[model samples]
Target: MSAVPQERRLVTAIPGPKSQELQARRTATVAGGVGSVLPVFTTRAGGGIVEDVDGNRLIDFGSGIAVTSVGASAEAVVRRASAQLQDFTHTCFMVTPYEGYVEVCEQLAELTPGDHAKKSALFNSGAEAVENAVKIARAYTRRQAVVVFDHGYHGRTNLTMALTAKNMPYKHGFGPFAPEIYRVPVAYGYRWPTGAENAGAEASAQAIDMINKQIGAENVAAIIIEPVLGEGGFIEPAKGFLPAISQFATDNGIVFVADEIQSGFCRTGQWFACEDEGVVPDLITTAKGIAGGLPLAAVTGRAEIMDAPHAGGLGGTYGGNPVACAAALGAIETMKELDLNGKAKRIEEVMKGRLAAMAEKHDVIGDIRGRGAMIAVELVESGTRDGAKTPDAAAAAALAKACHQEGLLVLTCGTYGNVLRFLPPLVIGEDLLNEGLDIIENAFAGI
Candidate 1:
């Protein structure tokens, strides 16, 4: 069988005997804070399926939370990383530099938005990339306040948790977080009080006004936002919203940072989500999809702004690990060679069509949003569709459980915990894609 098989197989009940045993062991060893959606332990995963310890090959729609955009077992990524591994695992780039690090940075300069002289610093996680980006921004602008948006999620680190909006699972009890972070409204289409049509302009205007009156643009070091808010939900900002914000940052000399961690490397049918709106930021942070499932993150930006931090101010011991850098290079090559961007667009088309049909029959689907392979279906209470559009977290949860039982893997997100996000690998075949959608429809019907 290929990495992405053309069919789905069910060996036993979802969390079959083996997975159940693992689940018991995991419960005792894993921290209570750490969580997972389903209890099935995977033995191998590739293409668009995850084989559990019990031999259940589940159709994967999450793509390991959008990290494996080029496919977890992509041949190019495996080949490069394996070769690099045999040569030498870690000499530590900072201790003694490597060609892989320089080559990865070179590729980032060419691929990231804007033709301006750009430089990048690699990190091990999205949180690290985001934290470093803020550090760079503050150093460059010499300001204290950092601006984020409602329903925006940066990471779990102290500073990023301050940047993130949700308080329940992310920020609760993790208090005394990094300060100087301010939050504003995001152009969330469905939940916007006025209407979807006015959501963009209204949200943008309110955000800008709030910044001017509350935070003062002159004192803000950076205004970081996801072109498509990831964990907060796949909320694609309104049409003119991003441009307005970008222009404001330019005028104020603020370091505008686009957090493309979840939306880069052709995940949104473009090189980056900001490119969809032709809005280029002074800085861009990328991860998740960059290394074909390896832990690698980068903050790329205009050379002058990036150089704001003094010499010896950046880098970590494993910042640009040789294996991870090799994987990133391979991932980039795979994206270009296979044209995964076009595949993402096709995935979007297939998903939107099936989801629209699902919506016609199920009123719980209050909204269908997102771009390319990063699509989501917002669930709401059935009868409340004409009124407040109350969130149906229960329904979303039930549907997810139902899908898991049926050998399909789907993940839920959103501020209200009602959005079922679909992040299939770019390499997923049409048959597997449709099978997953069909499973979703059955799940909804079951609910």
Candidate 2:
């Protein structure tokens, strides 16, 4: 049904001549700090493939960093968005509320992890949603300190930069970050100081102790975390970690927020990753996969908490543009009609199976964890026989580069830069998925 061919095809080299020219032009105009994973310039994309200007079709695995769960050119999303565009493009929701915006909020209420009366406010990016969620929590709790975890990534804004843990590209030289933000260790199963079996209880106890003794739980506004760490590598916390932390927040009257920006909207085999452990949050921030590649984000939460901020105090000029809202509605339709959550589960099954096989053959893959299409493989020094497990960032970089050259797009992430994260579109064909895995297998064999 899609115009773009679903199969990967190579008429020329991966970054063909046209892409090289475009890259040169991009370098000249675009900011140097804005990095790219693959150099090819896409002419069209749909289903499992991104067709470049050079007529080469590359299998897409990144999903524009987990934004295109329904595929880039989803039928319903395009139709609804284009219809909204023809009627009128930008009547800011704050200026004049639209039905599309209200409808999107309604969907968020129904789909996100709870049955409680929920309310939502839309935004233009994940960072804005997170920032606003923090503002609302602070307003509700009347507290100052906010707690985050090691390797957690919130955003690029001043406050969020402080919430984030990585320093190199995210926080480097962007100092004098906001105060009252605290960091604690997460129950990282693979890297836990104690064994994985003890991670859930030990890390929770340590974090709770630090909050009480140091920050004082009474003074904390919110304890926000990604149910599954995204930019921090796809590290899902140990089995009981989320429930323990959520209980702590509830006991202390501190708001518990789930930064589900990258792990929500069917990317994690469920509407939200937090549902996996049944650990509902007081607030949840979402984006990335909500609107079929369009820029949209939301902060959805308990009605009482969401209402804490005086309404006029919580809106941006372009917060919920009508067109983006329409796209979101259409995206939600596609997700339900096709059962993208099930598709995500299937992706996880296939990916984990293949990755496990790869791990058996290649010792570099230290760990493979993540739910659904939001999967990652952490690379370690090849002969970590003693299990020092030193991160092999260079190998990850080389592997990604090799995949790129072979017309398969892959992304590397993690605090240590040693994670190969795969976020294939949920609508991707199983054949394309297996082909992409074959490419990864071949690439690893070469490595």
Candidate 3:
């Protein structure tokens, strides 16, 4: 039913001639700061394949950084979005509200974790949602300091940059960030000084101690974290870590916020990563996969917390645009009709099975982590294993290049830039999934 052929075929080299020309033009016109993972100019995409201008079809493992969980061109999404465009594109929800906006909020309330009375406010991007979440938390608690964890990435805005841990590309020179933001250690299993088994208890204790000693818990407004660290190597917090921190926030009267931008929807096995540990957050920020490929984000949580801010205090000219809201409803419909959650679980089984075998053969793969369709391999120096390995960033970069050359699109992330993450569409075919893994294995062999 898809127009694009769901197969990997190379008519020419990776970036073929047309893509090369486009890259040259992009270099001259686009901002130097705007970077790309792959240079191929896509002409069409659907299912598991991205077809470039030169007619080469590459197996897409990134899914536009986990945005297109229902496939880039899902039928329901196209139908709803096209219908919305035909009727009306924009009335600006704030100026003249439409049912689409309220419908999306209602769906988010039902879909996101918790059965309690909940509310939501849509935004244009993850950064905007995160900023607004902080605002609502501050207003509700009447506190200042916000707590974040090491290796956590919230967004690119000033307040988010202060919350982010990585410095090089994210925070390098982007200062002075917003104030009253505090950073503490997360239970990073592979890198924790203590063993992975002990990381949860030890790290949580340390974080609580620092918050109490340095910034009084009474002064903290929110404690935010990614249930599964996205750009931070797909690190799922060690067991008990999330529950402990969440309990601390509850005991201290601080709002517990879950930054589920990259890990929400069916990207993880569950609708939300926090559901894995049954850790219910007071506030949860969602984006990336909310609207198929459209730009939509939201902060959904307790009704009281979401309504803390005055009515006029929370709105944007383009937030919850009618067209985007329509697309979101379509996406949710597709997710339910197709049972994307089960598909994500299937992807996890296939990926972990193959990756675990590869790890047995290659010591560079120090750890294979993540859940469901969102997975990753942390590359480290050769001959190292367990918790004794050193990050090998060069290896990660080289391996990614190899995968690119072979028409298998992959991506790398992490504070050290040594992690190769995979986020294939939940609709990806099982054969294509294995083929992509084969390419990765071959790349490691070549390395």
| Selected candidate, larger TM-score, 1 vs 3 | 3
Error of model 1, residue 46, in angstroms: 1.0
- Give the Å error, residue 414, model 3: 0.7
Candidate 3 lDDT over residue span 111-166, tens digit each? 88888899999999998999999999999999999999999998899999899999
Ranking by lDDT: 3, 2, 1
Q: Model 1 over residues 112-208: C-alpha lDDT tens digits?
A: 9898999999999999999999999999999999999999999999999999999989999988998889999989877889987898899999999
Clashing pairs in 2: none
What TM-score, to 2 decimals, does candidate 3 have? 0.99
The lDDT per prediction is: 0.92, 0.93, 0.94
Model 1 spans with C-alpha error above 4 angstroms: 1-4
Instruction: List model 2 lDDT by residue over 1-447, tens digit each.
Output: 467889999999878999999999999999999988888999999998999999999999999999989999999999999999999998788888889989999999999887899999999999999999999999999998999999999999999999999998999998999999999989999988777899999999999999999999999999999999999998999989999999999999999999999999999999999999999999999999999988999999999999999869898988888889999998999999999999999999999999999999999999999999999999999898238889999999999999998889999999999999999999999999999999999999999
**lDDT score, residue 166, model 1?**
92
Clashes of 2: 0
